[model samples]
Target: MKIKLSRIDDRLIHGQVATVWAKEAGAGRIIVVSQEVSEDDIRKTLVKQAAPPGIKVNIVDPEKAVKVYNNAKYADETVFYLFTNPMEVVTMIEAGIPIQSINIGGMQFKTGRTQVTKAVSVDETEVAAFRKLAEMGVELDLRVVATDPKGDFEGKLKEAGL
Candidate 1:
């Protein structure tokens, strides 16, 4: 499958992603590659239901995503990947999914997490995973929507003293 855009958003299939980012990426399919979400029937169902008309949604674990990506089963499909955290992105990448860049969209406020951008919050573990991804040549695009100016995610992490 061709990766149009990869994003780490806690709200997986929200308004901005369902409309703005999806349109910008021209994605035919949204692949929510998160083990936790995939196993949660209610969340998985809700995410699938939230997709824009004409776009397919696939909720799968990192392992299944890697297999589908490597097998070229969706070679003709333009896929936009969504993950909840940077660590899951790392997992998928290490499992052989060829992700070159990732959009740090939304990481909800939580205890012990430092706010990097207004919409992004990260903790020590996430910062480490993001650093690892950057070290592996993955560009991190920090943007809230298609209209927002993209910022440097790693730089923001550093600025936050991560």
Candidate 2:
């Protein structure tokens, strides 16, 4: 799958993700993978309404995302995959989904989440999951804005005392 972007943004589907992100990335479709959004009929409808004027928003459960990931035939599709939390990716990886690179973008400010940089934060469990993902050959990165590129999350974790 030619995943344009894989992001961990807590809100899952928002305006920036719908319009600004889609336009800037030139993505044809967006897939927001989450356990909560996929199962909620109301939320799914609302997100679809909020999507960009032309592009499609595919709201799918993590399990179903596995199928989509495996079956997608669009080599240059420029589709994006997003999850509400980093742990969701961890869960998916443990379930045997293959992920390429991911960016930590919009997790909320929380206590004990030591700021590794402006965009990424971590405590203990997240660190463990990240480590496990790294062991599995999944590349992780941190980036704040569209213009700015990403940095290695493993190095950031080291600086954050992980």
Candidate 3:
């Protein structure tokens, strides 16, 4: 399956992602790669019910997502891969999933995370992962929505309206 973008947003299947990025990327399929939503078949079914029939929504576990993503399908259509959190992206990378870059749409401020932007919060470990991904030539973008796209947090956070 061809991927348009790997987006990390706390709210997996929401308005901004389903409509904004989906259209921007010209994506016909949405692969929701999350353990929480995929592990429970009930939630998976419910999310499918939430999707617009024209678009394909496959709520699969990360492992399955990677497997399907790497299966070597030569499709002309683009697929948007959505993850719930940064760790999911990190885990996918660690597990050999090829995510060139990721966009930070939204992440909840957890206990140790310092609020870096209006919608982004990063702790020590998360910062390290971000930096590591950056070092690995992955472009990490920071934008609350499609209209307000920004990125390169460690270096460009101050330049952008964080």
Candidate closest to the true structure, highest lDDT: 1
Q: All models: lDDT?
A: 0.90, 0.76, 0.76
lDDT tens per residue, model 3, 25-125: 67788888898988888878877776655888888887887777677673565788888766677777878877897988887787976777777766667
- What lDDT is reached at residue 130 by model 1? 93
Residue pairs in clash, model 1: none
Worst 10 residues of 2 by lDDT: 69-78
True-vs-predicted CA distance for residue 1, candidate 1, Å: 1.3
Each prediction's number of clashing residue pairs: 0, 0, 0
Least accurate 10 contiguous residues by lDDT in model 3: 153-162
TM-score of 1: 0.96
* C-alpha RMSD by candidate, in order: 1.1, 2.9, 3.2
TM-score of every candidate relative to the true structure = 0.96, 0.78, 0.81
Model 1 agreement with the true structure over 9-109: per-residue lDDT tens digits = 99999898887988988988899999999999999989988999999999999988888887756778889999999999999888878899999889999
